[model samples]
Target: MRPVSVRRTVTALVSALALASTAASPAAGAPRTIELVNLGDSFSAAFGTGGLQQVEGVDSCDQGTGRDHVDELGSHPRVEVTLDAACAGYTAQEVEDLVSTKPVREALATADVVTLTMGGNDIGWAEFIGTCSAAAEAESGPAPCDALLAQAPARIAAASSSAAETADAIGTESDARIVVLGYPNLFDDRQDSPLISAGRAAQLNDWTDELNAALAAAVAEEGAVFVDVTDRFRGHGVGSADPWILFAPEAGAHNLHPTERGYLCGYFPGLLSQVARTR
Candidate 1:
């Protein structure tokens, strides 16, 4: 029989060898996964594309219809979406507020990557679209659109500042790689809308460009990557032969939002391209 001291020494050696082996090779079937967190407003929430469901247990947030870009990204083999904090109607300031909330704060603590889409609401984009649509329906000239355009520069500046602040706050709370997405043009300038003229559509598209530029600058200010989907979405706006954005005659929340195809094809590819380049 082995002596007790000899048995003890043998057991320690075996345990050390096992531990070293375990450390050298990960458990079978366990692949490295990236923890992704989604944060922002309607664009990030994928408001119009899918069936409404609660997000992070918040009924009002409507996050889990599975058609959002985050969901598309989560479908990636290497990614696991740990949190979806995006909510419709949320502004940049509101997203900043989320950083202080327990759920978002905890999620950020372990996030490997964070994606944000905001600032459109802060600049009254929805209202601008509605107002422009109404004027077009009334056969009114571009005066109303012009007035809104005149006010847009200041609003864009404010929204850009707010976005920068929000990005900074998110960076402060997490070491995650931040990717911000810019809004796409809802109208194809090449075609005339039944309600709005081609020139007006061009104007709206131009405004979208301005908004994207401002957002890009703001994201850069906070060291976040800004992924622009405009190129991907070109010729796919409301007036295009094949529109990716939802268009409804009556005003509602989902109008102007991307469809599932839009998320899957346009936004997701744009995001992937940027992430790949950065990585």
Candidate 2:
């Protein structure tokens, strides 16, 4: 995998420092308890987006970052950030593993709302993208790209299964309103990079589209709310002049997670909208 970019690390720290003031504190009166529990992968964990709250001893896992949409949700006056069980590089199965733990389960038990954004890693996005890059280099036919697209369906099915199972597990633990967020398209237009062919970008977007569809269906099956952030992130994708999502950052976090702007403009609004309804 690629290292986190220097640009990303600096951006994250600055954004996180700015957003730190938004962290909600209990009001003077008897604290209006709005218990929010977050689960899933790096998106929810606020990895590269900055404002990272490193979990005390668990340096490896980004279970404590608070600058993503989850932080935005917690910014509401009454919301208490009881638990952010999300970790970078986690899949739906890994989320299930975290939820099954005693402390995390306890947090879920008191949760008023739970949000999940997972499955990209499970679908093997990096490997698929790698294949696409290779296909872009090929001077021959569609064989290389076709091989990657062919695997999408099975990948989607497996990921959907894991998502459904995770939803069920969360359901059993808390009566909190669940919201499963979708991934954003990485490119709003054709990439300017010589490394990525038009065909490759289209194929990758197709994979994202399929994954979002499967996730939506799974959330519906579990009677959970599905928040689609795809539209919000449209022109702000990776290839845009001012992309909301980060490309392969070389150090602190994963490659394709949202940027600080993505969380604030793309994810934060959608999630904050749900708070009133879920409550």
Candidate 3:
């Protein structure tokens, strides 16, 4: 057997060699994979497009359809989607509640990024759309539509306030970057559908612009990034030959929501661009 000092020095050398080997290995120096958490409403959930599938540890109401912008982002080789808390018909308050849930809170703690798409339901966008469609169809006079339009500014302000509060709530739980996505204009004013006149479409687009502006301000105030998809969605509104928005004559949950292609092409690219700039 070797002498005690020689044995000790040999053991130290062996340990140092092992550590050096590990340090030189590719896995040891590789960047950690990014963890993304999705939170918001139907748009983030990709409702009415991909078939419903239950996500483990997620609430039944928050099941993912596997086709939302979150999924698109998750497809990146370096990113892993740890949680998707978005649900159809969820308002800003509902999303806040989701963030407070134990599983979501745990997920947020480890998240590197969080993406939110909300405020539409908070501002009664669906009802406004219905009113606009009815007016365009001549099923009712423009009074109801006009009234809803008049309410838009105030409602948008209130919704923007809620968005800021939600961002604060999210910030408290995670150090992740928060990305808020604004809704796209649902109509192409140049190509009007029989159910929606060009004038009505233009008015609706203007309302969307107002909403986006308010949301951008709110998000900025909260130190979160706001992604505007309007440019990506241009020329692909409801009346376009290749529309990205869903159009239904009867009132339904899916109407005016982005289709699968819209999420893939519009929301994903817009978000990716913003994320790259920040990085």
Q: Summarize candidate 2's per-residue lDDT along 1-279 as a digit string, tens digits.
A: 113553354345434433432333334544345688887887788865654555543335664343667775566556678887777778899888778878888888988888879888788887776666634557645676678789899999999889988998899988998989888887655655444665577778777988999998987898788888988888776667777777754634545668766777778767766655543
Across 1-279, the per-residue lDDT of candidate 1 in tens digits comes to 324653454345334433433443456854355678888988888866756666655546755364756775576555678988898888899899888888888999998789989999899987777667745547766677788878988998999999999999999999888999988888887856764567777877888899899999988989898999998888889978988888875535677888777776667766655433322
Candidate 1 ranges with C-alpha deviation above 4 Å: 1-31, 57-59, 64-66, 134-141, 274-279
Candidate 3's displacement at residue 56, Å, is 5.5
Q: What are the root-mean-square deviations of the candidates from the true structure over C-alphas?
A: 13.5, 6.6, 13.6
Error of 1 at 162 (Å): 0.2
Colliding residue pairs in candidate 1: none
28 Cα displacement, candidate 3 (Å) = 6.8
Candidate 3, which segments miss by more than 4 Å at Cα? 1-28, 53-66, 134-137, 248-252, 277-279
Per-residue lDDT for 256 in model 3? Answer: 76
- Of 2 and 3, which scores higher on TM-score? 3
lDDT of 2 at 93: 90
Q: What's the lDDT for residue 252 in model 1?
A: 59
Model 2: what TM-score?
0.81
lDDT of 1 at 161: 93
